[model samples]
Target: YRVHLEHYMTELLDLTVAAFDYESKTPTYLLTQFLSGIDWSVGTVNLISSIDLKSDKRITILKALTLLAGECKGELDFLENRVVDLKSQIGSNTQLHLRYDKNCDYIEKISDTSQLCTRLYCYGRDSLTIESVNEGIEYLDSAYINNYKYRKEKTIYTNIEVASDLKTYAEAYLAIYELPFLTYKVNLADLAKREIWQHEIINLGDTLRIYDDDLSLNVKVRVKKITKDYVSENIYLEFVNYLYLPKFDNIAEEVAYLSEVISNIVSYDDPTKVSVDAIDDLPTIL
Candidate 1:
């Protein structure tokens, strides 16, 4: 697994920094200020767009960086010699495809919908509401709302005072809450093999495609975690925004069974054939 910035910058003395609001500033500028506050050096930065940071209290430098990244859809790359780089986003432009075969131990998926919210009522500082940005509607709806039969509503409160900034915050919140928590677990020892490693390598935040023809499933997901044991020659990975259930064989069997049931229902004749009794002048079933 690659190193995380939080781990390297974990010194108690260098962790927390005084927060101040920086308006009409690019993310790169805010990042530099936080690093400078902690006396850390900076390197190349490729971030774009101006955003607001509404921090009024002291916050961890990591938290400050996270908020800045989230607002801009960007990520930080901690480089050698304590230099930090901010990019528009992390991961490779060329997505690699991984297929299930003998090397794959299994693929498992997990989903949690307990916190799913289709609509949100967001409140900003000074009694500002999402109503203005939401076309005069009292709340904002997720684009995924139509996927569900009924609406799931939730309320969110933020310290942001600007309408445009509040819109950004609420939309981000809705996007996360509207989707069910999904994760895919996969173990592929073959990825450690020199032959495979030479062809492709995966890292955190990279997008990947999974192919399983027998299960009739092909999905694209982002890598959330990775583990490798060099001594054991094993590699394990976790992905997000993927399908549900576990083990390809079980899912395939369930799908086949459902398909057969539908086939049988379609082929079966109607059982409502009825006849009338002429003498009694009463309806009778045949």
Candidate 2:
């Protein structure tokens, strides 16, 4: 990012043909250039993409990351499987937590919230339309059609519903991990052959959540099992409820303590700017 940023400023701002002191294609220089425009209000780094991809340096880093991804593809694939184990661990821990036998029933709630159920629908058929929407979720088809067909940039989210504000306990739980939920990133395009309904949390969040630094809160992982057993096969069954976070004592102090515990790790490398979501972000506890 620094390298790319420097190149952008040098060329775009007309810095000159000789202001290039460092490698214009390095991440360091791109980051430097990107940080130049950032306004750190109250120690908060507030700025959008510093090194635009068009920059030679930014492109270089992109290629490098891509190359690194290729190099680590084997390990990455192994890690992907580990992600399933992690989820199972999360689910098991949740069960133990919910049991509340010195286990604290908090884990179950966290696991539920962690499962982000993403649904995809294409725009109208005429103008860069959503040729189709994979509403059922697990059932996916037509990779290219599922993805590029409806531009996340152009499409607008409809019927934004607020199903209860972010739970105070859940926020506290999240604050603890600083980065639990490894965010399991996966590529739907490469993973799929024809249609693309697969997604993680990042890209979708860009189009979905237009705010939050234009970045998604979580990363999406596409599970390979395309043909999940449909209800058409099974007759009567229990409503399996998942995709839930957690909430502990509404007490700000306790929650704050949890926040502090995680804060140490979350901002361990950073300058401690990530706001530890306090009890105030929660509803007034009666």
Candidate 3:
């Protein structure tokens, strides 16, 4: 018996120092690495940090690998032998080893690949047992043609409110399909003294509102994860809103209401609510 294993390997190439700064007199370095391999063409590291310490510290490189895995399409494994520390000030350039393989856990299962071309179709259900014309094919003969006849009535359909306008509906549909998330870094030095003492600046479950002037986009999100760099005193916040899957009864009405709310806040020029260069430098605002 002949079996083929569909597998790919991705490796982090030479590390380059992106940023070097001093925080509270502590020397800090931020390094970036380019990842390339069989499956992945080119990938850039989002954030990296390195700092000098009195004693040697073991840093787990899995976090970086894990982030890369999420961006990749299929399953991937890190090539330990290929990983090399081209340049470093903290310690020796020894080859790092990983105990377990890293793979992309985020997988969206679909019923049929061909049905992806069709906009109106129901998914997320077993196609084999259920009679579904949108399932692509029932059975293929020697000629590679489907034996079953295509019938729209036989297929399971999802009942959703159809918007009148195509453009407006498209925006509403996309918003529900692709939920938005925000990620940004926060520096401690830019924050006020009183706000600095509070540890819940980037804490999870905290609600945040982000406004983009150029795009005219306003998103209300909750902090999902917080990654803090103690040496550099920099905190990375990842926020996401679980507001997808609109109510089936009034999709257009909901979309219109949301649009109105965003419009009101952006157009409102309330002096008390809006700040014009008030440099108190609160950590929560940052």
Candidate 4:
């Protein structure tokens, strides 16, 4: 029997909001508004009631969800009958360690330094420059520059106008780029079949401890992506150190997904032959 199928969270990136403005509202309230704006009927917002947020801008539904998720340290879980539950502190501090010597199927570790930068030049609304503690048009990561014996610089533009806010934004941007991106792709389906490892199905955002004896590496990472094959019942997972740094959508990924979606489109000349449910599943072709 084939069990792996589609989930409701897959539609997040396709939804967009032209504009949204909210001030001093709880994360639950903002999440409800975002779901309503996208006409999504499956999500429940009960996490992070203590935190209040304020924002006024246009953003994608996925981006909005990521922002809120980061604020709450939460993850979205798809439940029965298309229900999505936002759960806070979903990852446990008690790490589940995975090591090659412990009978893991396959493991590939990668550290990406292509996005690292020691300095960032930022431009805000109407030539508004950051002139606070770190003055000038650029913000520098002095520690990173000193350690590397050189500087890698990049430019960024934002809609924030206030000087203090711009400095904060620039610092955050610089921090993300100052460190190398690290991830591990593992195929642990075989291990999952074992009695000791079959306690629960691993989902996104779960904390995992990965240990490599040969490399002398030990680190805890969050589940970043999951890929499953319906036919083979095989599962693949990607773990990352920085969850919010690398965006989920990129040009190559977008193009590949679009191609797959187009290939899946079933074409029929006679509309009378298609059922209402089947018609509803088809994407609108312009």
Q: Which candidate is the best by TM-score?
A: 1
lDDT of all predictions, in order shown?
0.63, 0.24, 0.29, 0.61
lDDT of 1 by residue, 102-199 (tens): 45666886787888888888787778886776678868777678889999889877566766566665654554456776667888774535775665
Residues 91-175, candidate 3, lDDT per residue (tens digit)?
1122221111211111111122232111222222222211132134332111111223432121222222332222233322322
Off by over 4 Å in 4: 1-5, 8-44, 48-75, 88-94, 122-142, 146-150, 156-173, 190-192, 229-234, 243-286
Q: Which residue pairs show backbone clashes in model 3? A: none
Query: 59-174 in candidate 4: lDDT tens per residue?
Result: 77778777777666566665545455666544444457777777456789898878878777777788767755564435555345766766887887766666666665565455
Model 3, which residues run further than 4 Å from truth?
1-118, 123-175, 178-200, 212-217, 242-286
Best of the two (2, 4) by TM-score: 4
Model 1 segments beyond 4 Å from truth?
1-14, 37-44, 79-81, 115-181, 190-196, 213-216, 242-286
Clashes of 1: 0
Task: Residues 167-273, candidate 2: write the lDDT tens digits.
Answer: 22233333322222222221111211224512321211121110111233222122211121233221111111212223332444444544454445333345433
The best candidate in terms of lDDT: 1
TM-score of 3: 0.25
* TM-score per candidate: 0.56, 0.17, 0.25, 0.54
Rank the candidate models, highest TM-score first: 1, 4, 3, 2
Between candidates 1 and 3, the lDDT winner: 1
